[model samples]
Target: MPVAPKRMPFFEHIAELRKRLIVVVVTVVVLALGLYTWGWQIFDFVLRPVQSALELAGAEKLNILGPFATFTLRFKVATYAAIVVASPIIIWQVMAFFLPALKPKEQRYVVPTFGTMVALFIGGIAFCYIVVAPTAFEWMVAQAGGNSVQVLPDAALWFQAVLLLLFAFGLGFQLPVIVFYLMIFNIVPYNKLRANWRYAYVIIVTTAAIATPDWSPVTMGALAAALIVLYEGSMLLARIVLSRRIGEQKRREAIMAAGGDPDEIDALDA
Candidate 1:
């Protein structure tokens, strides 16, 4: 007779998390399968910028290096598309998991923050698709040294590069969401944010350089510039949104400094 396993103290949380994971995986897998069926059609749209760039550069054609490459490309592309298509559900599930941990004040921000995050990610990908993809490919083709060297790009490699840039920019565009939360949650103070602009700029530029698949200065510069704007905008918004919260915290700090009972900091908020 096999005994039943004992549940952990946090078994409910584990179960809830498992449920969310199952939903996300199922959603992605289903979409991936469907997308795989229509891959070339999708790829035609996805590779438009690269296609245009090749034409402008007078490249002969994009070639598949392997007999199995087309199938592999379709599968991979479908998986990426599925992940992207399922992002909203993914974001909602992840945020919902943390909603219970937030105070009522923070709870009100949940919907708007998640919505903004989704929009920003999509916007970032759009920017890359519209701008960086064409620019980077053109630059690359130019490096082939004119009409003497006929540019023949590998289909699999080109598609992979485009995917990397799109996702990198999308992830990069989440900077405001992160900065906004850190300020609102009092994890990082407004003063510190203002003071650390230099360090922030350095990090942003370095991240852009590393994240861009092609190492194109044009792509990196565009991403870095956009991030800098987002950072400043976030700082301004945080100053507005967190003004009252910051004031309350500072008052509580002063009370503690004047020898009030640290345990009674709750009294100060009132």
Candidate 2:
């Protein structure tokens, strides 16, 4: 008689998941505390661009909002910073959860995917903080030049808007990485996507327009143009990848066609 295979307890899987969750929670909390200690400095750094914009536009000092607003704002900034700092750990935890189910080749894709996600997010944040935020603020300030519009930036509103824009751009900048990965996975065919390029441009421009809160046509056009360029760049990359794969496939078929014998150089009898 064949012996029955032993079954592992279901709780073992649950325990493993629980352990990862605990690690992520503890790491985030510790980082949050560390960030809180330096929260004021971090907040100041984030606000510097806006501060400079206001100064350049000859606006007066930013009038902060109600009591306890400073403390709350610092806490929010620290929390966001901690989240950013702990992203790798969080990503690892998420990837680990699916580790058992992935094949070897699929497993190889994980680290690169994680890295790409992180890089894209950082790029997006930088784009927002460095390019989009400053330009948009300058434009907004320029709009108020003729009128005696005193800019009293509410601490809460300013920070909120800054965070929103930063995150929006950062997430937006992931387009190329996302599309390339989709192509790699064969989720979307290259020819099909290429054929729909016109529609894609329209959608990309629309997305950029929606993402731009201030509704400046120039800013929207800039962001959309950037995204479209990235889209084309991704397509070029995907083409190289697909071409390589096709060449390998053709070589394999050639070998197979040669009667499964590399030495065979002439037509064989059936």
Candidate 3:
């Protein structure tokens, strides 16, 4: 038997949140410290795609304008890497803080949904790095007129741009998971999403345009296309889940009407 979660007073809740936040901060800082030791290697890895793009355009390497620029860039890179590395702990802390407030059925969905979100986030980042970054950078390089203009990008700006794009794509890929929960909780109907797909497409395109770091149409279009697919796929899955839930509800209703316990019916069915 599962033990019921204990409810805390408002002040206690605040204290608990503070504790979790402290844990999350400590974890991230520790991870950051570890990453700082290898910050140069990580920076080089992050710079690889841009370097390739620059090479393809026969451009020079990125420039560091200030004395502290490299140090600052490495620190920033380590921080970003730390956040990525500590994401699971951060998420767990967040979930633990809020899980007590959710109903049992809602709680059941949390773990699976969180897992899906993490997988989608990683997939999105991978897509941005492997496909979007290279394509966008190549396009930007091409616009510089093939060695006519010096293509010396600022290292700091380049890192910021890549990190922003990666974060955007990772968060953007959570659309399906968000949609799934909305449908599961009956906050949004699957039919409604299906009906409003045109509006959804506009929203997706606008979001992709806004989220992408560069103004390259190829990158925006790719993100939009991927989001649309995820949205449609989510809708389809939501429909199936909704159908099964409705069927189960109807079956329970029929069982109750026939003077049979729904629990026993479920047990028998199982």
For TM-score, the strongest prediction is 3
Query: What's the lDDT for all of these models?
Result: 0.84, 0.76, 0.83
Q: What tens-digit string does per-residue lDDT give for candidate 2 at 125-182?
A: 8877887788777777677775767666676677777777776677777789778878
Task: Estimate the lDDT of model 2.
Answer: 0.76
List the candidates' TM-scores in order: 0.84, 0.82, 0.92
In the predicted model 3, the residue pairs found to clash are none
**Which prediction has more favorable TM-score, 2 or 3?**
3
Query: Which stretches of model 3 miss by more than 4 angstroms?
Result: 1-6, 146-148, 265-270
User: What digit string (tens of lDDT, one per residue) describes model 3 on residues 1-270?
Assistant: 122246889898888888888888998898888899899899888877667787876656677898998888888889999998887777767777888888766787777876887888899999988888887887877888855576677788888888888888998998898888788888987778788989989999999999887857988998999999999899889889889888877887788889997577775345
Q: RMSD to native for every prediction?
A: 6.0, 6.6, 2.7
Residue 1, candidate 1: alpha-carbon lDDT: 12
Full candidate order by TM-score, most accurate first:
3, 1, 2
Tell me the deviation in Å of residue 76 in model 2. 0.8
Q: How far is candidate 1 from the true structure (C-alpha RMSD, Å)?
A: 6.0
Task: Report the Cα lDDT for residue 207, model 3.
Answer: 92
Q: How many steric clashes does model 2 contain?
A: 1
